[model samples]
Target: MSDIDLDSARPIFIAECRELLASMESALLRLPQEADKDRRDSVHGIFRAAHTIKGSAGIFGMEDIVSFAHAMESVLDHVRDGVLPIGDDLIALLLACADHLGQLVDSVAENQAQPDAELVHDARPLLAQLNQRLLAVRMQRSPGAGDAPQRKAPAAPRQTGADHWHISLRFGRDVLRFGMDPLSFLNYLQRLGRITTLVTLHGDVPLLDGLDPEACYLGFEVALESSAPLSAIEGTFKFVMDDCEVGILPPGSPVADHLTLMRERARGDPAELQRLRAIWLHCASVAPEALDEIAAAATKPAPAQPVPAPAAQPAAAPAPAPATVRARRTGPRPGEASTVRVDADKLDRLVDLVGELITASASATMAGRGLRSAALQEAHEALALLVQEVRDSALQLRMVKIGATFNRFHRVVYDAARDLGKDIALEISGEDTELDKSLVEKIADPLTHLVRNAMDHGIEPPALRLAAGKPAQGTIRLNAYHHSGSIVIEISDDGAGLSRERIIGRARSQRLLDPGREPSEAEVFALIFEPGFSTADAITSLSGRGVGMDVVKRNITALRGSVSLASRSGQGTTVTVRLPLTLAIINCFLIGVGGSVFVLPMDVVEECIDFIDPGANDYTELRGQVLPFIRLRRLFGVQDTPPRRQSLVVVGHGSQRFGLVVDRLLGETQTVIKPLARLFAHLRGISGSSILGSGEVALILDVAALADITRAAMVSRSPAAAAAEPVHQG
Candidate 1:
């Protein structure tokens, strides 16, 4: 038997640390109030969260975190049973304990067994207060405390059951390097059932030179029969089960199959087969077919079982080893939940290269245009299809649910709202929305600022809300959904709608707006994001410093995304941000301006409209529908002479749409988004570049930026007052 490996134990310590922090964060953010009718459910949730961290830590013998979690869990248990209340004071103490436990877990993960002495000292008063409160509450319980002993504990399972079963197999050396301990399978199996038998497959070991000390040269053929059920057994291998061959071979399987397996093992040695035959007969219950099949297996292959799981993604290069020391082989049978984990960075790098390849392929395909031969034409068509597929795969790799980002904001809302003493709740929607991983990372900070701003300024105090004929508790909602080719995330608060009067007064006083201008509320509210501008009575370090809003706008703009705000006096305020799905390659409907091609991201391109020369169109006929129009020839100043005919590329951002006039419509093409270099990053309406088949570099038009420009132009040319048009419909 192998000894417990300390080196392998380290990863467990690290994982436990991560898990503890997640649990602590999740719990503190969701702590229930004392008067909540469903308080037990809340306390129980906290208990389970702590219990998981403690149990996982216990598996690796990280007693410090486990012990701390135990203390916190005890209080949760009392609260869960209503022996102690879940008041603000208790939640405060428990949250502090959770914080300390996170620190202790981190220390252990970094291999520091002896944490700072003062940490334990700091926890003493909290622990004492916790225990004292639990005791005092228990004493105060009316009759229930005296009757506590009468309650029976939860039922425990029996030691043995018929549904028990086990599987055994030795894996190749390749399996060991993946850091999977063959023994963990046994431990995992035990969780599924009372393991009836475990046998090492010494039959597969090679001689010493062929034996790899670092590699798993031997496998185990295990038999597990359990009543707990088969699904759990399957789930145990859910992560790595595909790496090794797995099947449910019943007891007393075919004797011929066994014999074939044995004969194959014997390798035509008559003496060995004879010995195996005698052992099979002596076993009494060994299947005759198994005995007979072992011989046939030596010459003919054994009957097909499921194939093992494929090695991890992208298949790492095989490490060099002496041929004598062969690695063990493992994988799933033919069909199973067999898969391998791959480093996301590797996938990202591959996608980037594939983008370059698409450009190169497009150029090469275009180069073959002159030949016009049937063979070359066929080859070009095939290459085009292949490149299209590659582009799709690259795009797929960048798609990740917006949920991961949403989950992180829970802690932010919890902590900020608590500090502000607001009974605010954050409701999330459309978390299943997807976006580019890179864009997701950058959008996080801006989202955080928006959420914090809503909590600090947009939402109101509980008492004021109740006085206004509204529920006492305030709500902040974060929602994300697909709109056109972009993802729209909105953070809204049902607080006193942004104070329009206050915003107007502040903008005027700050000289941000001219006096007696009667600026639209949208324009007035936009001033809040101006640097050093805030209408708050007093500034606090948490917010209202006037530093965060500018950063929020700057970050979103850097992403080629836009933020718009809308609010009513009493309804609510909504900050909506629109971001592209992936910042990489895009499916573009290319158009030409003065004969030069330009790609508009397909998601934003609504439809193409053949332009009929405008001859003083009536404002009533097109009043609300005046296509916000931009002239590409004028915007980018293309050199080639413009065609007599022009087409309108109608692009959209939410409900807003605009037409871009170009000389020709170049049809659909797959184009990679190559971000403009730093020197050119500040260019207007040109967000990025994409290469064409002739190696021509086409610019990606930023629809949001173009919309802004067109809107500005429309306003400037308007006969009405400067602030007449509606700007913020948040």
Candidate 2:
């Protein structure tokens, strides 16, 4: 491959290595929880992931990854064979190795020729740990070997004239067509041991005029001198096994096996059989006597018994174990869905084009309405439907399941609980919920902070849990589901819940809350999210400088989302994060205030009503309920005078309801969200901007921020105004 091709392929290799590392870590985590029968499958999966990574890294000439993955694969190989027992210590060591491997892959992503000095230093102990494990396993397997030294002495050199393992390979014609280079496998084989001799055969190659450039018609006979197991040698070709025929003859093997390999390769052609026999005898250094004995035995037919009936034949003979393992590691089974990995930039560009198309479609529709042409209007109505479908399809391509993101918390909870010396288990539900890919990526950090906080602060210690009449092993639950056109993620823990008194006291000491004022449960709980507010008596590594929760709130808010905290005195606490399905475009309820247009996410808008009480402001009675309202004209400082009639759009955010007073109800429309420039980022009550069909820019309202403003406005009202009856607005 050219330098350009290699540069382009490096990202793919890096991405695949990361995915494999993730799979390896997940499998290692599950080892302790799986049953004996199921545990074997997991072990195989982990081994295959490591093996594939090493092979790919070798192809990329990434020596760091290859060496580390090779060491990890050795230990995993023993585990798969039941030589090393599964235990907590082994799993922990392997998880650490997986982490180190991830770091190596990160270096590759950065185009570093090798891991930096710090990473190299970090890898020493991990590699040492792997070597120690393998040494221990070997000691345990050896007969009469007890209390062996930590470091074994080097073995004596191999004697001269020793027989070598002979390997025969004949690649299928389509090998090159599938983007595989035959020499790469041979290079990987060198990692196992020395290849003393290699002979390439081109007997199958046609004349120059008849040859196809893309077809592979070559074979190889290799004399390898190594002590590596047969399985390891076979695994060198695992990725291409389906498209190649491989035969291995170990030293000291019976002559019958060699004869069988030769016959299989030669098929039924006498000339080819003779050619193979001669090559094995001369080139592969096979004994002539052994071949003659095998030939004589094959020529003499043995006495046969009566042939069995068709039904008496064995039904579906078992396949070789190695073949079965390879099958599992290959691509998905028949009838299963396969995926093509696309770059995130490409997906983003596609979404951007779709958004532009939506704007154009809306503009065309508006033009058609002005012309009052029935034919054009009818055609555009159809075009509008098609555009809607295209918009949905384009967005759907970016929608990924949240399960992968949620599963990542398993390791987080595990490590945190271990460090805190607490017994906590993460229980997941509704993991199959789907959300925008962008949201999934951005929400992970916030979710991690929330999870760690729950483990550190929310979940009580084992002794405390027992005293409180709860299970000694506390539980942290991550549940996700879609509701009201939004994805709701709930992270709850069954430990001592948030203490209202403690929170309020902390808030007051920090001057975040007034000393004499009382607040609702929701309001008290929300104080924890205030910057630099903490109820902890002392600082801890995980949290307690009061930095995480505030950032969590800020991040969720920036995503056009809302976070709410609900807790009981002793029951537990649940942090609920609600976010729109996609950030690029949305169905919005457009309203006009003093000739200025604003967009309210359609999901949050409950209903619209005419403002009946013109005399009242800020507070209104909606069907006997005290509904706090914000007048858009006053909020955005629109200079146009209000008309005689105004509209109130009631919207619900989390547990609060607020009404936005506007001058005109524009109904619903599809709005493509365009982010505001950095200069306008500090503006409150507006999350983004959008361009309408009339070429006018409309501000996308931040519903949560507006709700907060409404609450603040209601709280500032005078005692007499508060005591006054709210004007009926229904």
Candidate 3:
């Protein structure tokens, strides 16, 4: 039974451990800038993560994880106690320890009874470093044991006269059956402080015939003398809080606190009330009158009605038990929604169902449009609204903050900076921007490549940056935000920006540049994404291969996204990646070109305007600006004569603008984007196909790709032809 329980809980434990590792890394990364109070909080948080993982690992009997985490927790403990000062060296060592612990957890996840020998061998040096620091702490405390004592300021003394914390614990009957030893918690508590006094109660023990060997029926009243904070003591029993009833009274707590604990503990048993009073009188400095009042209240018949909740306090006292403290840690104090840990597969299944619901709703709406009855149309309209709401909610389930992905680059920048002997600082902004989870995962590798490339090739050495009147430390900024119904991620660096001369040189050498005509600045910048294109003067491990940039463009395009590069010679370089919010389903403007239907993602559709001439010219004047337009019929090689009354669908892709001339506007649609099969994946200006309510296939137009095609066409035309009034023969 124990084995079965452990197996059932292993996955949850692993998931929590991974979260703890991420949080630990984040705290360590921010340690350098934290203030004194913030630093203490950060250290304590790091300790809790390690301690929780250690305790949970011990429960699963993963000794490799427990042993290493125990050591890491010890070092964090010393740091928390102010015995060890935090520094870059210490933080580095701790980060390394975190990595090793992650490896141990991964080993367990791989079904290994023990960690790999190579990993264990690597951990030895880190363990030694940790223990050496711990040993130094102990020696420093011992009188006359070291040459010079380098000690931190003394911790604040306990506030009141009392010095012993009062702890009350009642082990649940299932504790023993759950493989938890009551005495083990006692031993762990000792690590925080000395237990000055203990009173064990066995009143709950059953008769001989009723006793169960595996059941636990013990309680303890302990007086612990220590300077540890209330949070630290509460953390001792955090794992078992749900399984057992636990209460803690801080040193010098008010008599009211003890009274509260007694009332809670003595709910039904009169003997239990007397026993608790006896223990409280022995451990606390409360007067006999307070105990008499509590005893008197315990004996009085409880009110027949349930007690009302206490009113809110302007300045409430801290909670004493681990359970209460854990609640406060988990969520906000008020109006917080209860959350459950749902499996990702479950959420994905819900999204798939929602997609189907949207499709069906569209079909019903289409059917209703053909009906002559207004009542039927109204009903269908209501249903459509409900389905749209459901779809939004479903998509939101898969929208995750990009903070995790952004923070991951901290380590990348750190390692790359060290490897290149450069001083680079990463500044992350808009981390809370939410996007589709699938796009987040797919964009990670490409973003990583771009970030490293910027650091390696775009950013100059620190000396050069200083000479350029910039700060000694180069800065790389990662910014994300929502723009026009899409998520835009920008990776910008305050470094020596892209060199136009060098880029053009490389493009010319690669035969990517047309010698007959000069390219626009945008065209020159776009050359960087050409396959096998690079401007690096020499081959280096990071960037000279020229493979990553082109691949980045391709991958982003695969997601129906676009990547644009902007740079100035001496200012900086910024690579902007624009991606759809969700690829599963979209609201599109369906248009017809010849006999084929096309869907333009509504988010990019600026407006639809009357087309004065279908084929008289390739550019149109919209307001005062020359809007370059692409003829869909010509672009797709439609053999049919163009419709006499065509319409232009104005679309914007980042800063570039273009128009698409269509045969007819089919109005708005709810579309589920279906990826093209491999045989047709190479089709230009089309991302995927969608099935409309009429059972016709509509090619979902790639606005970014079409904008690119427009730009390319403009570049191929003569200057006069590219002008606003140029005439072209079909």
Each prediction's Cα RMSD? 12.1, 8.1, 6.3
- Per-residue lDDT of 61-101 in model 2, one digit per residue for the tens? 67777788889988987786677888988888888889888
lDDT at 476 for candidate 3? 94
lDDT of 3 at 483: 89
Instruction: Find the 10 residues in a row with the least total lDDT in model 3.
Output: 151-160
- List TM-scores for all candidates, in order: 0.67, 0.79, 0.85
* Residue 262, model 2, lDDT: 66
| Residue ranges of candidate 3 with Cα displaced over 4 Å | 110-122, 135-165, 171-218, 224-260, 263-274, 287-335, 368-374, 514-517, 538-541, 614-616, 720-730
Task: Please tell me which predicted candidate would have the highest lDDT against the true structure.
Answer: 3
lDDT of 3 by residue, 1-730 (tens): 3687778888888888999999999899889888998998799789878977876777777787888998998788778767799998899899889988888788777873556767878888999999899888878776766523232221331222356787888887776654466876786576577776677889889999998876889988777778888777777776677677777777545555666677677887777777776667665534444455656666766556543323431233554432222111334336857777878788888988887787777788778888878998999888888888888998898999999999999888876887798998999999999999989889999999999999998788988988889887889999999988899999999888988878887788888987665677888899989999988878776788878889999999999999999999888999999999998989889999889999988988989999887356677677767778888898899998886798988888777788898999999968898899999988998899888877788899888888788777777767775664322111
Give lDDT per model, in order.
0.66, 0.80, 0.80
Error of 3 at 660 (Å): 0.5
Q: Candidate 1 or 2, higher lDDT?
A: 2
